[model samples]
Target: MKKTILLTLLVVSSFQNINSQEKREKDLLTSRKWYIKYMKFGENKREISDKTKNENWMLFNQNGKAEITTQGIKSIEDWNFGKKHEIINISEDGKFTEYKIEKLNESELVISRKYLNKTTTLGLKK
Candidate 1:
């Protein structure tokens, strides 16, 4: 009976460790910001509008304040993992454009916007 209890405890401990590790990895990956690589309209390729590549950074304070930044735009985003795990926000530069979180996976995010005459996408760096 003692041996069985020990085995069960060991198995439970192992599962706990795995669960914690998985959660940590998920949190780390989810906190990262993803940018757009290319934008296309039907069959045409749009010019890359983001001039400063290194300026892009996704900020997550873990307190519900998340922002994604690039050259001339800084967006305050809302992330909801239960329903949609992506950065959704608007430009802070007064461009009056709406932004959407296009794709967010383990290591990347794709952000996009539609303005008066153009649609832009930015590829995020990890």
Candidate 2:
């Protein structure tokens, strides 16, 4: 009886984990499109539509495909939420970039990445 109880608990726990993962994905990806509000590269912050005249946007699809549009050019990529939805990984042309999720909600998505002693934080709005 004890073993049976343990097995049942394990099954329930597995289902809970699956449900949590699905919920996370739905909450973060359902919007389909997110526009970059700004990006902070270390101490410098670049606002959207600044003097640079650059536009950046991201699209997340239910099929695990993502697209990044910059300067009217779109790059196709595959994307996935990291374990526990703590990060987002985007792969394109055999290159992968992982962005650690700082905050995600119905209207906002914030992520950051650190490389070569520089940290870039990007804020997005739906």
Candidate 3:
């Protein structure tokens, strides 16, 4: 009986820890609006000197909705994360695309997507 109780407690605590971590990640992601500050395109990871701030930005809501504006075009979308928070999925117009998260922190985020053997990475600042 003691072993069974201990095992159950451990299992419950593990689940709670996983849930808390996911929640923390989500909260960090939704805490602020992110502006595209850099791009890993032709050059190495460098700041985009030509674009103005807020010209290309994204905002995530805690309710699973997202707002993305690029070059003055705004889109309403839905977003979610993978089981381990290694990937994020954004859905627009009933279609969803998965992006691999290269880095995420309180003030910066980096994500990459692949298409036809080509990969593009975007760095965002809070």
Quote each prediction's TM-score. 0.43, 0.80, 0.86
lDDT (tens digit, per residue) of candidate 3 on 13-55: 9999988988888888999998988877544566765457677
TM-score order, best first, reads 3, 2, 1
- Per-residue lDDT for 34 in model 1? 45
lDDT for predicted candidate 3 compared with the true structure = 0.85
Which pairs clash inside model 2?
none
Q: What is the lDDT of every predicted structure here?
A: 0.57, 0.82, 0.85
Lowest summed lDDT across 10 adjacent residues in model 1 is found at 79-88
Model 3 scores worst on lDDT over the 10 consecutive residues at: 42-51
Per-residue accuracy of model 1 over 1-126 as CA lDDT, tens digit each: 999999999999998987675455447645655443455653466544456554556665455456766554777865433222343444355433345667556666666667556666655556
The C-alpha RMSD in Å for every predicted model, in order, reads 7.6, 2.9, 2.1
After superposition, the stretches of candidate 3 with alpha carbons farther than 4 Å from their true spots are: 41-46
